[model samples]
Target: MSARDLVHPLVLLRRFASDMGAAIRVGGVRGGLLATCLLAVGSLTPAYLPQSSPYWVPARALGLDSWWAKALGTGMVIAAVGLLMIAWFNVRPTIYVGVKHWAVLLWWSLPLLLAPPIFSHDAYSYAAQGWLVHNGLNPYEASPSFLPGPFADQVAWVWRYTSAPYGPLALQISHGLVELAGLNPYYSAVLHRIPALVGVALVVHFLPRIAILMNVDPRGVAWFSTINPLLVIDFVGGAHNDALMVGLVVAALYTAYRGRMFWALVLIGVGTAIKQPAILAAYPIAVIGSGWAGWHVRHLARFVVRLAYAFAVSIGVFCAISVATGLGFGWLNAVTVPGMIVTMAPFSLIGFGVQNLVNLITGDPNGQLIWKIAQTLGLVLSAAFVVWYAITRSRTRPVSFLAWAYLAFASFGPALHPWYLTWGGLLLPLSKPSPRVWRIAAALVSVLLVYDAGNMAWRNDLVGLALAAVAAAVIVLYRRYLRGHRPLAGLGYHDEEGEANA
Candidate 1:
């Protein structure tokens, strides 16, 4: 967008280390040391990914099936989490916005970007979608199985015949990468990941800025989300496009905070093109932009009109991208495709227990029917909650309503995935979540890291165990620190009225 923006991210990132707060400077050093440990863990993960990447070791050296390799992986994962715990919460509240945290994030995340896809082969699937676009096929209607090549082979088997669930804008990015590779699918899968690095840079840059504006310590807040192990491994290591979506959404939030409502809407629309989770951001932003904090018939009408205008502009952007790429709106149904998954979210878990209970009593099994009914009910309730919150009056900081509402959706909605957690997890920092929120988020991270159910389920569990260990360490250290010091007074506070609402 500007010559300054075109400056290399590395040079820019290094500059961020300057002018560190006293607390931040001290904690940042610890964060840097911990980041080195994570770097080693991420470097080793490529060998264990579903499909080997360019940096993968030979079978003899990195056999995922071998007991010793499994043990080594368990140890590495535990060590990674433990070190992260010590850096993030064990010490005093440190401001972590400087060079130390940025370097740590870069050191840990950079290598994985060039390594093989980790956690999921969604990158390969994205490449296949791009291949469809390159070959003049509609990605929404066409499946990766339509193309037979090394790229298609890299996609997971179950998804080979499935149309892309991601937005068409995402298709354009992937397609452009493959096109740049001269239509070579193999290179496309790897090249498509380059954009995610840019996304990381955006997160690295904007999150600190957002924290500062919110009157919080940018150092720890930024470190907690930006250098987080889950974000690092999934985004950089797995090359998931979720990174792109989050970067756009976060920047959009920053824009809205700065009072550029129109640009915020535009960013939200563009981010939706990356993933559907971002689409949810539109509601809260629209509500805030409407400026109807009071109840009146005219106020209600004004709110609706403003909301429609925002959607018109955002949807107009989406339509333009679809038309330009010739990738029609088949993605409309893609978001609903998750209805088939019996997710492990709290609402779904309750339904699952109820379904199992009914089956035992009736001596007949109707798990599917009951589960679907419960899932639908849960989704309805979650959506209602979101709408209620979106329209509610916030004294200041519109992110308050949006952050809490979106988090409720993620926690209770039917669709669940570890990466999906980042949708609200990243924004939590912007909203100034309470200590309880941080504890909940920490626990969820540990669980999500190991929640895979089939195929590599056991291997996932070991990694999960490591994260659980790390979670335990965090609780212990947090309590230990609580003994010596009073509760943290945030970096700064707002006016009494602002604080009440914030």
Candidate 2:
């Protein structure tokens, strides 16, 4: 190769860096950039690091276990969430046109690229599962605890004995990453995040295209979906495979919306091979394929055909991956593993409460029947809602239908995590929701961020929790003061043109 050939790539790299730098210098992007940087630094504290992790040793050595480190890290992360929310609301399609918005995402994501899993230890389970697969074991049948090694030690205790409930493709990918990491537990956990980043990248690339097709503001969609704190904390920071699944579902939805039914179904199939919940995406795809003109019976045949095609394609992909990975069908039986824990899910909570009440009244404290009944009832109700919405509302707003369906699944399922909400929350912006809907969504996001951060601190260190509360209180009071005084520019409450739009 000539010297000019070698220098050509370098020139392009430098030019790209310069352009991104100029973009970041804009005041509109600074808040989010600074927030992500803060999040990255805060994540290095001992609280965020897995206790059994090799990564935690170094953090402890750095005196990050001190009260100040704990409190400050907690505060920084909470403050980062607040700032990111503010920055997200301020993002206007008129102002952050095109790649400028992407530039902001790049800056925000860069800091979290290598951080330890935040808010969850599920990534460690990923490492152990990959280790099992690498050792010629079926993760669907064997818990991580079977081996009793470094990898197994890193998984959360509650899940260490639970068989893998993830799809075969995810296990295969995990095996490859674990093998690539030389079986080192920490690196395996960190390397698992690569798939998540790929998923996030796919969403960043396709969500805007989908939005544009639906006549929504592409920039707004990008900002809402990509900069979502839930995405950052759960998918990227916690390294959840749902990122890959959601990314593929978004791409499939885009293709289906664009009239490529076969390809859309294929993408949905592949996505289902990563996580079963992704199959829910096919309902919307089928609706889009039907070319709905009205509630008339004319589209019924097309819808059924499309739905059947989706089912066939998804089942084929699922079985193909199962056979290819030699992990046949065991995951189907293991799918209920997450339900072992009673979470804040609407039905789970009700069941627990009812069980307690019945036990108190009947003097049978060991009773389990009531809880099981409530859980089953919740699943049935959630399923009924999904079917009702798919039939009644999906024809007009297919994407929104899918979003609400996923939300129903989360709320009424056996367990609900903050990240579960993102499955639907990410799609709301693309549906052209009303201003009130945006307000509600934003408020939920803010509340969840604070709760998760506070909960983490409460679990790990009470002192940190108190300090974090103080920090949050200060921010809340300051925001009130700002509202009373001069308007905060770029926050949508006061735009450049002096409109109080928010």
Candidate 3:
């Protein structure tokens, strides 16, 4: 009961945490497994948090979404993700060896896959969209609330009254799940996520090839791309369609690397059918496949011929999907939803800045007007960048160019959702981006996870304050640790020497 006795136990706990941190920092796959186990334990929090039916986890009935639950769950998540970053940087692919070693991540991913949706209920919209497809309704034209059901109720209010802003391929798969699961939303959601699981597997399979194309360590690429807490939380936990979209994009990039232009275009088209931004990937691949990166006139002619063939194949495949699914053109409208909402995206921040300036300078306080103008400016910039990147490869490599384009879209696009980060995150591993870029991405991901709307539901700056504190602590600890210990073999990744051996 004495202060020294209390201090002793606290010291012991700190020692224990320090050991775990060290283990994740330099330990191998075994260390990663330990981190995954802790993350799995934390994953239970979302399942237990109180939610309505169809979104129920075993603990949901206990009404655990109270203030205490929030604090505990959030802290657990922070610890797990922090550990995950450590383990990811420590990965040694050569020691791990082969797909079997990498499959350990999928095992770690399973528990979260079974948990309730964490950050977003877009999966509910997917389920509702699927229900529409099952009933021969166009998801593009129909809202979930148009006919409420177990799934429709779980969708966010903003989306519940709006049509499904997802790919036709996703809707088709969801429709099949709905038909199989009937009116039960839970089963329908799980089934919908099966595709996401497949997507994750695809990412794992192709990540090595992607690394080879970029001439980097597959271990670093795979570790950063697949073994992170964000991928686990967003792809497996939330069942976001971005999972499948990015998976397809990665696969297409791999195929393009192998000079399989026909297959690459087919895959890219299929990806585009899953998400709109994926179409951007096709442009770079088209230029690469057709050898359009060259300056010679004959090269341009060769590029045109090759591009024509690639286009024919992709267009043919897309048309077949459109015909087979009987859902055409409606999804085009769905792609514009993020632009309609004003989120914390860079453009949205610019809009807020413009709105404030207008209010102060002109005594005209029309936030929407400024927001719209800012969005238009962003749209123009993003479009121009993408067009330039696509048409002329110039100094940048094709795949690398596409990756930057994805980042441009995410940063400048409206209503930036956390899940959208996967668009760039998945590909960034294929090649090395600047450390500054990675830090920026980390900051954005941290803010998004902390400010997740479905869970926190607060507009206050509390999350921001907490994130700033965490960032400061991490920086201080890292600098101190580096001053004391041997520098990391690589900065963001583990032993470049060891990974190169893979």
Best by lDDT: 2
In Å, residue 352's CA in model 3 sits off its true spot by 3.5
lDDT of 3 by residue, 184-251 (tens): 77667766678888788788789867676556666656656766556777787778888888899888
The lDDT of each candidate is 0.65, 0.76, 0.65
Ranking by lDDT: 2, 1, 3
Measured against the true structure, the TM-scores of the candidates, in listed sequence, are: 0.80, 0.88, 0.79
Ordered by TM-score, highest first, the candidates read 2, 1, 3
Model 1, 169-284: lDDT tens per residue?
Answer: 89989989988988665567778668787777778888778667667667655656787767776777667888898888888766765778799888988887787677667656
Measured with C-alpha atoms, the lDDT of residue 502 in candidate 3 is 23
* Candidate with the larger TM-score of 2 and 3: 2
Give the TM-score comparing model 1 with the true structure, all chains together.
0.80
- Residues 281-391 of candidate 2 have per-residue lDDT tens digits of 877777674655565666677567767887888778778877888888788778678887877787888889989999999999899787888888888999999889877
Looking at candidate 2, what is the lDDT of residue 406? 88
* Sliding window of 10 residues with minimal summed lDDT for model 1: 493-502
Q: How many clashes in each structure?
A: 6, 0, 0
Candidate 2's C-alpha runs over 4 A off are: 1-15, 66-68, 91-95, 294-298, 360-365, 463-502
Residue pairs of candidate 3 with colliding backbone atoms: none
